[model samples]
Target: MTARVPDAPPHRRQGFGAFVRARAANGALVVQPRMGFSDPGHMRAGLTATRAARAHTVGTVTLDSYTRVGDLDAVEPALRAGTPLNGYPIVTHPGATTRAVLDGVAGPDFPVQVRHGSSLPQHIFRRLIDLGLDATEGGPVSYCLPYGRTPLASSIAAWQECTELFSHARDLGAEPHLETFGGCMLGQLCPPSQLVAISVLEALFFRAHGCRSISVSYAQQTHPGQDTAAVFALRRLCAALLPDVDWHVVVYAYMGAYPVTEAGAYRVLREAAELAVRTGSERLIVKTVAESRRIPTVEENVAALEYAARAATDNTTTARDPGTDSQTYAEAQALVEAVLNLHSDLSRALVMAFERGYLDIPYCVHPDNRGLTRSRLDEEGRLCWAETGALPLGRLVHTGRRREVTAAGLLADLSYLRRKMDREAIGAPPGTELTGSA
Candidate 1:
C-alpha cells in the first residue's frame, strides 16, 4: 500500500526554494559553499562569513562521515579527541548546539541546506525536523551508488520514509525543500542525458512522497556548451513535468578531478560561475581553491564565493542558448519518458530502469548498476559514450569507432580539465595538450 502524507497548512516563512527564486527573479545568481566544520563555533563563523560575502549566497551544514553512515557513537569521541571531521556532525551535536551554529546566520535571507551523503537518511531528517531546518539534498541512487554498497531497494525505501518525514516541516511554518543529487551521480564521466534523467526522476520521487518544493541538480561537466545544453534541458523538463511544484535548477561546480594548482582551481570555478550565468541556473554550489589539497578554511571558502560572484557579474550579458532542439535535450527527454512509462510510481520505475538497463550510469561500479556502459572524453574535451550498453538513446547513441578506456586513457581524461586550465592560466598556446609534466 502506498503511504499517504497529510497536507499541512501553507508555510508562510520563505524557505530555501523561495530564497533562491527571489534571487533569480532579481537577476542575482545565488552561490553556496560546501563548507562545514566539527566545532559549532567554527561552523557558525563559516556560515556568518558566507552570509557576509559579496556574493548572493546560502549556507550549508554538510554532515560528517560517521554521522552520515549512521554510526553516531563515533562522532562524540572524535569531537572530544580534537580530531577534525570532514564535515559537521549534526546528529551527534545536540539540537541546541546546531541551532547555535545557525542562530544569527541562517534565516529568511540566508537559508542553509544540509548536504549529507547518506543512503539511509531517516535519522538525518528527524534531526533536521528537530532543528527546524527545511532544506536538504540527496537522492537514493545518487547517495547510494557513488558512496557505498547499500542496496538500491533499501535506499529507495529509506528515502520514501525520509521524504515523508521531511515534508512534516511544512507544519512548522517552513517550506520543506529537497534537492536531487542525481545529476552528480559518480561526480563525473557519466553522460549528461543520464544525469538529467536521474535528476528529474528524483525530483518526481520527492514530489510523490509529499515534497512540494524541490530543486534539480546538474554538475558542470567537461564542455561548457554541453553543460549549458544539459542545464537548459533540465530546466525545460522540470517546467513541463513539475507544473504545480515549486522547483529550480542548482548547478554544482565541476565535481570531479580538482586542479592541483591554485590558479587552475580558481579558473575552473570562474568558468563554473560563467556557466551558471549563461545557463540561467538559479543557484551554484561552489568549490574552493583548496579543493585539491585539504578541507578549505572559512577564509578560503569566502574568497571562492566572492570570486564566483564576480565572474557571474562580468558574464551577465552572455547570451543564453535555447536548447530546445539540441541533441542533449532530445536524448534527455527520451530517457525521462522511457522511465515514466515503466511504472506509475517514480521510485519503482527508477529501480526497474536500472534493473532493465534502460537507465545506466557510465563507469559506476555499484552492484545495482549495469556496468556495460562506458564513457570517454573526446578530443574536444566533451564527455561521449564509448558504449551505450542498453540505455534507451535510440538514434542518439554514438556509432563511431569505439576505443576501450585503458588505464592511461582514463588518467588522461580525469586530468583533462585541470591541465587545460593550468596551461591557459600560464598563457600557454591554445590547444596545447599537456605531456604529463609539471
Candidate 2:
C-alpha cells in the first residue's frame, strides 16, 4: 500500500527543484554539504550553520548507516545507549523530533534533502513525504550497485514503488526532487561515458516512475577536460530525452581517495567548483579538508562551502556549449539507446542490461554487476576502458592504447589526484612524485 503525505497549507514554501531552478536562473550556483548528526540538536545546528553560510546553499539530512540499511531495531539500541551514529536516524527518531530539527531551518530559500544510501527506501520516502519534506536522492541501480548486496530486481521494484509515492508531493504543491547517484558509481574508476549513460538512464527511470523534477549527477574525475565533456553530454542527453521534465546538473567533488594535505583538499574542491561553473552545472556537493582523516566538524563543512562558493565566483569563464558530437556524448547516447531497446519497462530493461552485460560498472563487486568490464587511466590521466566486456559500444570506445590495469597501477591511479594536488600544494614542480605512504 502507498503512504500519503499529511495535509499541509497550500504552497507553504518553494519546492526543492523550484529553489534550485530559481537560484540557477539568477546565475548563482547552489552549493550543498553532506552533513548529518545523530542527535536532533546537532543535526539542526548543522543545518542552521549551513543556512548561515555565505554561499547560496541547501540542507542535507544524510541518514545513519543503520537506518540506510533498514536496520531500525539497531538504531533504537544506539539511541538508547547514547551512542552517536554516523548520521541522523530519521526512522528511529520521532516525526515531531525531525520536525523540530527542520523547523525554522528549512524554508523557501533553504530547502533540505534526505540523502540515504538505501536500496529499499519506501519507509524513508514515506517518513520524509509525511513531514512535508519533498526532496531526496537515490536510484535503483545507483544505490544498489555501489552500496550493497540487495538483488537488482528487488531494488528496482522498491524504487519504482518509492518513486510513485514521492510523486504525490506535487499534489501538495511541492515538486519533489530526486537526484541520481549513477554518475558516482563506486566513487571512482568507472569511465565517464558509462557514468553519463547511467545517470541519464536513472533519470529516465525516475521520470517513467512518476518523478517530474530531477537532477542528474556527475562526479569530478581524473581529467577535468573529460569531466567537463561528460557533464555536457549529461545535459544534452537530458534535454533531448526529458524535454517535459524539470531537470538540472549537479557535480560532486572527486569521490575517490582524498588528499591528506589541507591544501590538496582545497585544490580538489576548488577544481570541482570551477568544473561546475565552467560546465554551467546548477549545483555542487562540497567535501571538506578533513575528508582524508575523519568526519568533518560543522565548522569544516561551512569552511568548505564558503571556499567552494568563492572558487565559483573567481572563475570568470562562463559555460560554453559542448556540442553533441563529442566522443563522450556519442558513447553515452548509444548506451542509453541500447538499454532502452531491451524492454519496454525501464526496470526490466535495467535488469536485462546487467544480465546481458549491456551495462556494467568497473571494479564494482556487486553480484548484480557483470564484473567483466575494466577501466584504466591513460597517459593523459583520462579514464579509458581497458576491457570493454560486452558493452555495445562497438568501436565507439577506443581501448587500443589502453593497457590492462595492474594491482600497483590501480593503487597509483586511485591516488593520482591526491599526489598531484599534494605536489601542487607545496609548489613542487609538475611530475615530481610525492614519496611515502598516502
**Model 1 lDDT tens row, 1-438:** 001223324647788888888888899999999988999899999999999999999999899999899999898899999999999999888888888888878899899999999999888999899888899999988999988889999999999999988886676567899999999988889889889989999999999998898989999989998898888888888888887788888889998888766777888999899988887788999998778778999999999999999999998855465657878888889999999999998889989999999988877789999998988988788888899889888888765887978999988888788778877776777666543323
Question: Which stretch of 10 consecutive residues in model 2 shows the poorest summed lDDT?
Answer: 1-10
**Weakest 10 consecutive residues of candidate 1 by summed lDDT:** 1-10
Alpha-carbon lDDT of model 2: 0.89
lDDT per residue for candidate 2 within 1-438, as digits (tens), equals 001123334665678877887888888889999999999999999999999999999999999999999999899988999999999999889999999999988987899999999999988988887788889998999999889899999999999999998886676557888999999998899999999999999999999988888999999998988998898888889888887788888999999998878888899999999999988899999999888878989999999999999999999496566777788998899899999999999999999999999999989999989999998888899988899999999978778765767999999889998888888887778777654323
Give the TM-scores of the predictions, in the order they appear: 0.95, 0.95
List candidate 1 segments past 4 Å from native: 1-11, 318-320, 429-438
Q: lDDT of all predictions, in order shown?
A: 0.87, 0.89
Q: Which pairs of residues clash in candidate 1, taking residues 3 or more apart in a chain or in different chains?
A: none
Query: What does each candidate score in C-alpha RMSD?
Result: 3.9, 4.3
